[model samples]
Target: MTSPPPHVAVSNYKGGVGKTSLAQGLTVAAAEAGDRVLVIDMDAQGNLTRRLRAPLSPNPDERFGASLADVLQRPAKGEIERILVPCGYGGIYSERISVAPTHFDLELLARTAGQAASERRLLRALAGVTDDFDLVVIDTPPRLFCHLIDIAWTASDVILMPCEGEYEAVEAARRVKERVLEDRHTLNPDLEIAGMVVSRYRSNLTLHKQRAKEMEKIVGAEGICPTRLPELVAFKNMSEKALPIVECGSEGRHMASLYRDVYKWSRDRINTVMKGAA
Candidate 1:
């Protein structure tokens, strides 16, 4: 008698805060922990999709059959299950993770997402796949006005926001929280913004600490995660190979440990939220 796992979303209104990296790292690490994780790529850029090695790349020679766009517009029984494909990239636990991928076609959903009940489309589509995985992680678009973010927000039980150590990035998190709080009230009452995960942090720098304090103002002392991911040149290079930091051998070990700490924090947050629901 296994209960359905909760859906989690990774998002930020600002771009280039290592949002995709954080998403990829968490998903793979979750699978490494022996949990079956489903990662939904709601971003049109499809960076997570590429990292997971799911088909339907940005430019493919042959057209792939279905994507998140098709499912959102016309959700049917088992449609999400049919759309989900294995993540063949992660060394041993790769098959434990699955992906409901996105592409440029997803941009069409953003323009027309204002239709009645449109925000609930993702929630409706995911209903039939409750027994498929132990947890679901969604990678949302970074733009403020994009409906992909709305779709993920509506469907998620908890969301993780990532921000770089900068004024603009921290401000973006504040603005996004203000907007999504409205969405939660109107759309899904159970959804919550778990906390903010500070990415690309430079502890040796003074200004970065100031930026972190500014973020604390937005999410509060408890709302900010304790473990922060540091900026690494290898992280940039790992993106090319689509490897999670933890599995990249020696060079990635440092950042990998930081990511594991964040993972534990997220797991605790999710548990607390779910227990409250119970």
Candidate 2:
């Protein structure tokens, strides 16, 4: 039997660090590599959901019938499989990638999920689908929703954090380390940081360069990714159109390569760690 797919949570406490961009790119690349991919959009903003055309609704009760909110709030056998909808726009991997889209009610659910059993609810729900995909990428809400973020971290084997090259983003990267330690101690002992990718980088900015160096110190040079995603207009254009970078015009094709490189780098790191464990 094939080994279970790796659950990758592309997370950051700070917003606009290219978290969603990275998640979408990684899932697309994974699918291209012959891995059936599933992207779980845990962010209430539904940015990933909209881009992937997974499913969406402002009304929780109405969307719960086909959104992630239902899987988390009301668990039943086959619920996860039933909610998975295939990608409608990913390049080449459009059919290979699947998504568990989000609903606006996710914000409320995060607030009311209660402390007890908050983390495991997602893990339990995902148990049935572990073998269904080669990779599971979770696009999380930035900062505001801790409970749902915690669930993503708990169920994940590796967390890939995207940090913008700046002081605040660097500080956030440090806090991410602390959160990982806390989770290892109290929640998921197997949880680990796959590595940190410096996104939205501009080569000419001195402060950006300085903070990128600082981030390397925090996660260690080994944990810092070599391929950095440059600040490009293509990202915004692609996002606005609700299309994957790979599917965008030729410019997007070039930009998509950078993101895919990071995914391959991250996948190699995860595989190395899993092999060591075995």
Compare the candidates by lDDT and give the number of the best one: 1
**What Cα-based lDDT does every candidate model obtain?**
0.81, 0.79
Relative to the true structure, candidate 1 reaches a TM of 0.92
Give the CA lDDT, 0 to 100, for residue 260 in model 2. Answer: 77
Error of 1 at 184 (Å): 1.7
Predicted candidate 2, C-alpha RMSD: 2.0
TM-score of each: 0.92, 0.92
* Model 2 regions lying over 4 Å from their true place: 57-61, 276-278
* Residues 117-187 of candidate 1: C-alpha lDDT, one tens digit per residue: 88878888888686878888999888876677778888888878999999899999999878867767876
Clashes (N, CA, C under 3 Å) per candidate: 0, 0
lDDT of 1: 0.81
